[model samples]
Target: MKEFIDYLLKFGDLNEQQISCITANAVETELRKDAYFAEAGKVVRQTGFMTEGILRNYYYNSKGEEITKYFVEENNVVICKASFDNEIPATSYLQAVTDCRLIIFPKKNWEEISGTVMIWDSLMQKIISRALVRKVERISPLVSQDATTRYLEFLEHYPGLANRVPLSYIASYLGITQQSLSRIRKNIR
Candidate 1:
């Protein structure tokens, strides 16, 4: 919860009372490897602050290939905005890449918290906006850069994640085959 509170601090200060109010609604949740936080065809019912492990946001193509769009590491928030906002089925899946700990707030408590903690909505807006900007920045490079350049950028950007995540998932994230990623790694070494 400290990680979540610290993340919220980026928006503004929170008094002890406000913190208590917010914390009162938080619930700890866990996901084992490959567990889905938000599955495709299910509506998002909670917003989670990831305290440990990693999550991959992915979708399946018509050919049934998994296309990894992004990775959410520890100390980040996880939410399926489209499904949460529209109250419709999710198009993407948020799956745990490793055992995970998350501080979650159910949608049922949203009205109570958002109404009481005036800054909560604003804080979320900023976080989501920043994420979208980063998404755009990442997408541009994927389209313009070569696979090697993209893989190098990934290594630079994500640091230890290359070692932590499975090679196949990393390859999917790079929009390349596992064989190509292996060859790149060999050549680079």
Candidate 2:
């Protein structure tokens, strides 16, 4: 909860009372590895602040293969913005890549806090803007880089994430086969 508060503080100011109300409305939850935090075709009913571990946003391709879109590591917000804001079924799945701890607020509580707190909406806007920029920066290289360069950039950008997540997931994110990723890894070593 403290970590979550600290993250929020980076985006905007909040008084003790406001902080208290925000914390009171949130619940701490654990998601086991391989569990789905939010699933495709289901409304995203909660927003979470990740305190530990990683979650991957993915979707099934036309061939029914899972294509990893991105990863949300500890100290990040976990929510499908379009689904959560529009109250519609998600187009992707948010799955725990490892056992995770998160501070979560149900949609109702989130809206209530926004309504009651004057700065809440603006703070959220700032956070969302930062997230969108980071997403674009992270994704841009994948479009032009080759497999090995993409893998290297992934290592440089995420820093230690290569070893933390499954290679299959990393491969999926890089648009390559697991075998190819393995070969790249071996050759790099």
Candidate 3:
């Protein structure tokens, strides 16, 4: 809990009481592998911090294939920001890739905290900025690179995600077929 508070403090200084309230009041949950943190069409009422394990955000296409959008590892914040920010039904699914421990807060609680705490407002702003940066970085390959080049860039960005996540999922995240990814791997070697 102190660790969580310390991370929050980086955005802005918070009163000790505010920090205590945020930590003590937030819900702590544990989820098993394949469990969903949130799903499409559900109203996402909570925002969370991933304290352990891995999670992924994905959406399904008309054909029912999952398209991976973002993966969050331990110590990162995990929220469907589009739903959370707009108070609408979620368009993406949030799933646990491994057994996970999470600290979560209701959207109402988040709103109340931001109203009274400058630190909370600053934290929200920082999160929004980071999300935008991540989206821009994800689009870089489409403009300047071919499939093989994009595969290399993916490795450069994530280093060892191939070992950590399923190859098919990584391929989907890269917007390429698994066969194409296999060909790229052979070409690299």
> Who wins the lDDT comparison?
2
Q: For candidate 1, lDDT tens digit of each residue in 64-89?
A: 99999999998888989888877999
TM-score of each: 0.97, 0.98, 0.87
lDDT string, candidate 2, 1-189, tens digits: 999999999998999989988988999999999999899999999999999999999999999999999999999999898899999999999999999999999999999899888999999999989999999998999999999999999998788899899999999999999999999999999
Each prediction's Cα lDDT score?
Answer: 0.90, 0.94, 0.81
How many clashes in each structure?
Answer: 0, 0, 0
Q: Model 1: runs farther than 4 Å from truth?
A: none
Tens digits of per-residue lDDT, candidate 3, 1-189, equal: 655677676677788788766866688889899999989998888888888888888999999998988677776787888788887999988888878898888887787777766667677779668767976797677458888888787787767666777878778888889999999988899
After superposition, candidate 2 runs with Cα above 4 Å error: none
Q: Candidate 1 lDDT (Cα, whole model)?
A: 0.90
Pull out the clashing pairs in model 2. none
Which has the higher TM-score value, candidate number 1 or candidate number 2? 2
Better of 2 and 3 by lDDT: 2
Error of 3 at 79 (Å): 1.4
Winner of 1 and 3 under TM-score: 1
The TM-score, computed over Cα atoms with residue i paired to residue i, of candidate 2 is 0.98
Which 10 residues in a row give candidate 2 its minimum summed lDDT? 155-164
